[model samples]
Target: MALKKLDKDTIIAMVLVSPSILAVLIFVYGFIAWSVRVSLSNWIGLLPDYEFIGLGNYLGLLKDPRFHIDVRNTLVFTILFVGGCLFLGVGLAILLDQGLRGESFFRSLFLFPMAISFIVTGVVWRWLMNPAMGSRMSGLNLLFDSLGLDFLVNKWHTTPNWGIAAIAIPAIWQMSGYTMALYLGGLRAIPESLREAARVDGASEIYIYRRIVLPLLWPVTLSAMIILGHISLKVFDLIIAVAGKQVALDVPSVYMWTTTFDGQFYGRGASIGILLLLSVAVLVIPYLYQTLREESTT
Candidate 1:
């Protein structure tokens, strides 16, 4: 009777979860497998061609100059975007942790940007960072000119080689608030007694932060880095809305979009998609392993 009851309960549990399991199997993993197969095929047109081309597309991407630019742009954008968010977020979090007046209002103000879609942010910022000079100047340049800071006004997103870096400004603006929330949560989780104890021991606030608080926030930082890095790697709509398809600011996502959808190079597009998946996995898998290991140890 006991064995029958246990089996019945297990069957009920499986039945409840079976729909979700099947959906994931069919939609997520199924599409992923299909994409992988597509990536290896010589498919290039309206009709599906499953002729296996092995690693040819991947090898072609390696030699492609446009892909190389995409890599460089991605690196520059990622570094600036991640670093700016971390710095600004940490600074804002620290300021807010001081029990400031209207703290709730300020927190919401900071996080409000995160609520806006990246596409919307990109559209707004595109106007703001307009690179026209002289009478044609507007947006940020106009503001600079009005302030009599003529030297500060220049072509922003069109600024050659460093054009990709300009995109990071808007990216940082949109996401820094999220990073702040993460850091703020980490900061609040810390005990007040720890800071008091450090102060009583004649340590400066800076010393306490550097030695104790910062060390404790490493996990939060790591999590933010992984999340930010993944977003950076897969950036598409933001760049599209801001700079269009300009090669100087092109990242893999943009390249993938053009190659796959615009040019109808499905094979190359699928290959780019796979590379993106692998890049995200490279960041996420290690974090997952570390998290699971910590949980197991705990």
Candidate 2:
């Protein structure tokens, strides 16, 4: 009788979750398998033509100069955006940790930008960083002129060669708050007595942070890096909102968009999509492994 009840409960539990599990299997894994099949085919036209040209699209991208530029832009954007977020996030977290006057108000002000979408940020910053000169000079250029600080004015996202790097500005601005929130949680989890103990031992505040606090925040930092890494890898909508598909600021996601949809190179687009998926997986899988391993050990 007891065994029957246990089996019945197990069946009920499976029945409750089976629909969601089946949905994920069919919609997520099923679509991924379909995309992989599409990527390997010779389907470049509007219609589906699965001629089985394995790795051809990937190989072509290797020799493509535009693709090379895309890769380089991605590298530059990812480094600056991720690094800036980490730096500003941890700094804001440490500042708030000090319990300054009107801390709640300041914390809200810092995190307020995170509430807005990246598209909104891109649009706003585009005007603020408008690169036009002379009569067309407005936004930051106009403001800088008013303040008599000509050197402070810049072409921003229009700067040649490093234009893509400027794109990281809005990204970092929007995300640093989220990173700060993560680090703040990590900082709070650390017991206050530990800092007191270090102080009693004649350690400076900076020494305590370097040796104790920062070490404990490593997990948080790693988590933020993975999140930001994947985000930087697949940046699309934000770039569109800011730069409007210019070649100088192009990244893989934008190239993929134009290549697949606008250009209708279906197979090539699928390949780009697949490569992007792989890049994100490379960041995510390791984090998942570490998290699961720690959980199992505990």
Candidate 3:
């Protein structure tokens, strides 16, 4: 009778969660499998007519210098992007958590970016960072030039290192807010008594935060890192909108889109997509495993 009741309750709980579970399985897992299948087959154009090409696509992807650059660019972007967001986000969260007045207002301001779409963010940043026509150029650049500083107007997005940073600005703007919100929530969840005890012990604010708060916020950091990593990996729309159709700014996702559609290298494009998936898995699986293990132990 006890086992039966337990089983009944389990079934009821599963039923309650089944809708979300089913949705994830259908949309995420199913699509991943389908994409993998497509990658193995040579397909292109309006309708996908798949021809089995074994590992030809993969071999081509390996040799493509553009793809290799895309991979390297992606790695660099992910590192810098994730690092900046977390540092800014957690720092902002900690500052805001100090029982400052107008907390909600500041919180909302920080979160405002989360409300804006990345597409819009990219467009705005593109205009701001434009070589000649951006508002920043006309507004600030003109002011600088008026002061006889013509060097500052010399094309912000054309330089190599700075060009990548220009693309990263929009991404950071859109994501940092979301990350700040997460860290803020984590901060609020920290026990008030712990802070009080630290205060009583005469621990400096920096020391308390570094030793106590940050250790606890590790989980939040990990979660945010994983989420941002995935986002960075699949970044496409922003790159395309800002950089354009061909692979000039050439991240893997943008490059893959062009190779498949523009260059008619469907096999190679699919392989690139597969490689992207692999990169995501490489980053995510370990993070998730550690999270899971920690959860299980705790």
Candidate 4:
């Protein structure tokens, strides 16, 4: 059969999207390939002189003490941030779905942080968490001081994992609203008749949600988890901005950044970058496969 001729408007629309398509392929895939190549080289600075080091960079990365710490920090951060966001977002969405009076107002307030840049969020949170200069001293401190509770302002970001929490709080605050919106849409997709029938059948609110609502939301939860994992893995601005050269709190992304800029170890930095890319891919691939399998069965 002969193919129909393409319309002028259809051809124009394809041309409009072609630049974006080309941009993603060139910038994203091209840079990824370049970084992988650099990771296998012994390059330094802007010099092109490099020996084929094979897996030398990978071996050294495994041996580095900081690499281990950064990995630990990243995993810990991913877990807490993703888990906290899901729990908080889903919980809030459920509450808001119950016909709250100012639901729109509350939603706007919650989403405001997501609109702010990560750099701005980090800077603002840094000011708010400083033991001496933060709201701990200025706002809560004054109120607590009157009650003789002066122990809370000593050092907020000095503890090991606590510092991680300190940095993640702002991130969670920013992104949880977005997750809430996702859950809200999922919740809205549920039929009201089913909920009413469940209530008539003597199912408690908790049981209705636990059995009926939660299972149906699995697809949304999986998608949100993948996105949150990716964001958490790539988190560098908040950590670096708040901590500022404190390697004690560095995650892998921040480690790669500091290695390239401060330590001037381009090959090692590229290697770290490649490692992080692999880590995100590892987390994503299994989930993507599961999703695709479920879709096929359905």
Candidate 5:
């Protein structure tokens, strides 16, 4: 009788969730499969041509110079953005952990940036980093000139070759607060008794952090890296809001947009989309597996 009741409850629960499950299966995985098919075809115009061309689109991307530049820009941006976020986040987290007066105010101040939309951040930073000179120098350039730091006023995102790296500044600013929160949580999770015990052993604060706190915070660091890395990989709206579609600062997402929508090269666009998906999956899958394994063990 109990087994029958359990089966009836399971059926009711499944029935309740069936609509969401079906929606995901159709809209998400179904569309992904369709895209994969479209990517392998010779479809270029506003038509459905399911002719299989295997990996031709992927190979063309490998040979495309613009795609090469996209890859390079992505690498530079990801490194700077991820590195900057981690450094600033950890440092801010450490400062907050010191039990400063009005700690809530400071924490909210630091995190306020994260609450703002990335598009807004990009728009504001674009103005601040404008390469205009003299009378047109209205943002950071103006401030630098006023302070007699004229040397600091130069082309920001407009600088050739290295322009893409400048975009990382806004990206870091918007996300570092999130990383700080993550680190703060990790820091607080560490027992005070551990630090006290280390102090009892004649250990300095720096030594305790280095030996005890840092090691335990590795999981938090790993989580931050994965999240930041994925965000950097698929950045589109922020770059567009800041720098438009300049080839010099091109990343895969931006390139994919132009290729698909502007140029109407559906196959190539689908290929870029798949590559972006794969890049994010590469970062996320391992983390998910590790998390699940840890849960299972515990």
Candidate 6:
């Protein structure tokens, strides 16, 4: 009778979760498997051509100069975006953590940008970072010229060889507040007693942060880096809104979009999509493993 009750409960639980499980298997994993198969095929054009081409699409991407530019741009964007967010996030979080007057107002002000979509942020920053010069200059260039800082003016998103770096600016602006919230949470979680103890021990504020606080923030930093890394990798709408589909500002997500949809190279597009998935997985999987392991131990 007891065994029967346990089996009944188990069966009921399974029944409750089965729909969600099935949906994931069908929609998420199912589409992933389909994409993998398509990536290995010769499915170019609007019509599906599932002729087995092995790694042809993959190899072609490797030799493609445009794809090369995409890689370089992605790397540049990721580094700038990630680094800028971390630096600004940490700085802003520290400032807010001080319990300054009107702290809540400032926190909300900083976080306001995050509530706006990346597409919207891109649109606004596009106007702000206008690349035009002289009489055609407007936006940030106009501000700079009026400030008598002509030397500070330059082509922002159209700057040769490093235009992708400019794109990172708006991304950093939009996400830094989110990063600040994460770090602020981490900072607040720390005990005031520990800080007082450090103070009693003659530790300077800088010393405490440098040694104790910063060391404790490793987990927060790691989590932020992974979150921002994947975001930078999958950036599409932001770049498109800011700079359109320019090759100088191209990333894999943009390349994949144009290749798959515009050029009707479904196989190559699928391959690019797969590569992106793998890149994100590389960062996410280990973090997930570490999180789960820590949770289980606790």
After TM-score superposition, the amount by which residue 69's alpha carbon in candidate 1 deviates from its true location, in angstroms, is 0.7
167 Cα displacement, candidate 2 (Å): 0.9
List candidate 4 segments past 4 Å from native: 1-20, 133-154, 286-298
lDDT of 2 by residue, 93-122 (tens): 999999899987888888898889888999
Instruction: Give each model a TM-score.
Output: 0.96, 0.95, 0.81, 0.86, 0.96, 0.96
Model 1 lDDT-worst window of ten: 41-50
In order, the Cα lDDT scores of the candidates are: 0.93, 0.92, 0.80, 0.84, 0.93, 0.93
Once superposed on the true structure, which residue ranges of model 5 sit more than 4 Å away at CA? 1-4
Tens-place lDDT digits, model 1, residues 1-298: 9999999999999999999999999898899899999999988987889999999999999999999999999999999999999999999999999899999899998889898998999999999999998889899999999999999897888998998888899999999999999999999999999999999999998999999999999989999999999999998999999989898888999999999888889999999999999999999999999999999999
lDDT of 5 by residue, 232-269 (tens): 99999899999999999999999999999999899999
For model 4, how does the per-residue alpha-carbon lDDT over 102-209 read when each residue is reduced to its tens digit? 999998887788888888887777766765644446544455566888775444555755567667777898899999999999999999999999999999999999
Candidate 3 per-residue C-alpha lDDT over 1-298 given as tens digits, one digit per residue, 9 for 90 to 100: 9999999999999999999999999988987777777778877665776787778778777787877777777877788789889988998898888889998898889889888777787777666666764454564456667799777765555566446555776788788988999998899899989988999999999999999999999889989999998999998888776667645467988887777888776666777887888989998999889879989999
- Which regions in candidate 6 have their CA more than 4 angstroms from the true location? 1-9
Q: Please give the clash total of every predicted structure, in order.
A: 0, 0, 0, 0, 0, 0
RMSD of 6: 1.4
What is the TM-score (0 to 1) of candidate 4? 0.86
> Candidate 2: TM-score?
0.95
